[model samples]
Target: SMETNKRNYFGISQGLIKFHPKQQYCLTAECIEAAAAVLSKINQSVDPCDNFYRFACDGWIYNNPIPEDMSNYGVYPWLRHNVDLKLKALLEKPISKRQDSEAVQKAKILYASCMNENKIEKADVKPLLSILRHSPFRWPVLESNIGPEGLWSERRFSLVQTLATLRGQYSNSVFIRLYVAADDKVSNRYILKLDQASLSLSSREDYLENTTEAKSYRDTFLQFMVDTAVLLGANASRAESDMKSVLKLEVKIAEIMIPYENRTSEVMYNKMNISELSAMIPQFDWLGYIKKVIDTKLYPELKDIGPSENVIVRVPQYFKDLFRILENERKKSPHFCLNSFRGVFPCGQQESLVSGTFISSKQFYCLLQIHSPLSLV
Candidate 1:
């Protein structure tokens, strides 16, 4: 058994990383892997009554099909783009080769039918049923009715509600508290300990009022664009004058948007890659976090989660300094600092404020300047 304190420690750490889209993928993947290992162990072990394997397997299925499209929606260009690539490769594989081959095949058929993407749509229910029947354990007993729904009940929580519960529980337990919301079910409360108490509807209405400020910022940014357009349009003799105006606008807008709190919290947002996030937060550990939270000690077989990389954050110099300050605060007090920016970067609200930063951009290009001393232009 893992140390008891490890559970609380990881639960909080994972909660903090959950705020960023990339980190959440990493953490969830870790859970699936741990659960898989536990399941394998139970199937091989002489003892089948072990409750640990049962819980681990059920938890895996509960959050299975991490809904890749919905998982990293509206995220920064680098992380969002990478996750899609990884998921595409994962789904492209034939079912016989998948980690949970039975379910993977079923998922492919279901998704193909619903979306009709022209990909493989054949479903094999035999392997799926075989796994279900052999498990000897049943879900719904563990609060997840995620097996073959026909064999279970159609009354299972909507995917949105189920995801919300998972997100909430994850936030409450981990270091990174992400802002996850499914359009189907928007919760009245933020799940992390920082905002355990429910916020009033009126208070949320008041917060949405930031749209006015957002619009003001948008107008200022638009002017900067107009000035750039003029700079490019101007004759060579007038180019310098227009260019200077554009530069001036750039400085002004940078000063206006991208607040201090958001800038300062870099480590929370960008430092750790998904793998590192899994290691940093103890709550998602193979032994302790799973054992305590799910009432099972056995770890699941690790799932093959993809897009193995850290989230890329383009931090301006100002935000870099802020990130250092916030990092220190996080080291000192984990729970207090994770959700400090809650009022500002709340759920479903765009946190991408500055223009230079492409934390939320889609069309990104990298300019590679390969300098060779032997080359002459």
Candidate 2:
């Protein structure tokens, strides 16, 4: 019986073996290169069981020292750097107007524009000043003679429209930040979410700290803002005053912001409909704001956005205080609210930026991970 069972198993194995493709040594260039890469990064002399990390990484550490600019080095960054080089090479390839796809041509055009320092310098800050001179974005710091559009009008001020337009057109979100993220409760579903956002300074600690270093950093930040406004045809005194207020407003936002430690997943998951959001915070138009920002022209399906549309309010308290501050601040300085809207004005700041820095910063853009509405990150 044992002999018969062994024979049966052998027969099955033999049948399956004949059906499988014959294995051969892969000596292709790609296979050899991949093998060489692994071989190069391993120290066979060191027993892996005794010292696994060193055995695996010693050769890699010896061969690839960290670059001067990077604070840390690893496989991920190395792969990213290689990918960027490949992308740069592809984008640098000459565009064939008739041959290339529209998307490829557009990418090539953008890459060419970024590389063109002379053309960018020639244009100067005119593009930026032109944007600021327009309705809703007319920076109050700039006087009437700044452009044909003249000074920002108090009559045209609508908090809902201004906030919405900033996000919609310029891709800048002021008080209310919108994102499309997977629901915590329903992992498979993606939902629109609103949160407090856009502070001038990166760190909330910068606003809260009373240390000398914090104070110095704040002063320098305020000075930078004032200098930027003055460079774009704003009066020095008025620029200083308005920017000081802007800085203060940012600090207030930082104060109200929920600390990272406090922002557990459960705390942030305040799911509700648009109507509930409006009822909760009656000062601002919740439905109008979301509708304005979402370009129904492009996303025609989104045109049916109504009070019943679902959304997650990440920080309800922040919105409550934010509207309260904006309401009080607007009464004092009617046109000043838009100043925060144009905080991240994309324009020529320094001569170096116009000359060589813009080209250098193209590398930064390639590395940047922006959390835009489109990205949903």
Candidate 3:
């Protein structure tokens, strides 16, 4: 009787009313806001069916013009800028709380030191001069007594020793870079690896090419080196002449180096023991240099890295060519300074601060662990 009453109703005659539950809209306020934000970036005028990228990104491209200082701008650079800003803010914060981590405190100190331009300026060349006056870094170009009468002693200038000092102390990789890394073949095990050092210019192509840009780059670099030498007490004329030789030597090195394109994993991966490597390239005392580097007070446990140690020679040909170049250069010039100018350069001080921050933070963590709260209590 109820069903008959419903069927006899006025709307039910035209089948306008149904018993099914009403359909509900699923979108929330937040969902609608997000959709609006996405839609705002799209150019409705440009048909997405014809050119999707232009339709999607036209509004964004119009809004964010590239800066004058930047050659290009992209998502990665924007992300990096945001991250750097966050890091700067974090580092600028003062260490007040007693419970604050030692690592955070050390990072704040390092950042403060870096930011203290007044102190750095006051210290001036003194810090660099101190480093230059030290054993291996006492560059003959910088020394007042270096000339025809008081030439640099070849006996005292051991390439191996100088290289070791640069690599170990300053972390400056000159002609060759030696470091411990995971074995390519056996990813689990760590082994020593040697590779060609980076060039002053961006690439070997910069030196090899005869283009106008290449020539300009090379000339500017030469002039810079000459100026650096002159600033460090070298006679202007002599510095110019000597730096020309160094530049020429670098060009030759560039010629011999394996091009990055050709240096595939298979081509570069040549694993051999230190003894075998020494036999292959006998110009330098590889074992002795490695021993000296590892035997430092910082790493007393690594004193006896010997000939039996396995090493991966990334570029065997580069080493062979490098030794030949070294021999020729050694015979030609008495003073062999490799990137010694870096010590006095103002840029180097800033670079050291930035580069050493991570290392300093790690050292702080180690010290904190050694003197933990339990130990202190």
Q: Give me the candidate number with maximum lDDT.
A: 2
Give per-residue lDDT, candidate 1, residue 186.
25
Q: Note the Cα lDDT for every prediction shown.
A: 0.33, 0.73, 0.68
Ranking by TM-score: 2, 3, 1
Please say which candidate is ahead in lDDT: 1 or 2.
Answer: 2
Question: How does candidate 3 score on lDDT?
Answer: 0.68
- The 10-residue segment of model 3 with minimum total lDDT is 350-359
What TM-score fits each model? 0.21, 0.72, 0.68
Expressed as tens digits, the lDDT of each residue in 1-377 for candidate 2 is 97677667756775675565774557899999998999799886775556879889988988999764333478987887787778777777899988898877877776677567688689887877777766767777887448657577888767777778877875677878886778889999988999878565546787789987567657767777787878777888988888889888888879999887988888998999999999999998889998898888888998999999999999999999988887888888866544443434653122112111232455435323121232531
Worst 10 residues of 2 by lDDT: 348-357
By lDDT, the candidates rank as 2, 3, 1
Winner by TM-score:
2
Indicate the residue-level lDDT of 89 in model 3. Answer: 68
| Model 3, TM vs. native | 0.68
> 1 or 3: which has the higher lDDT?
3
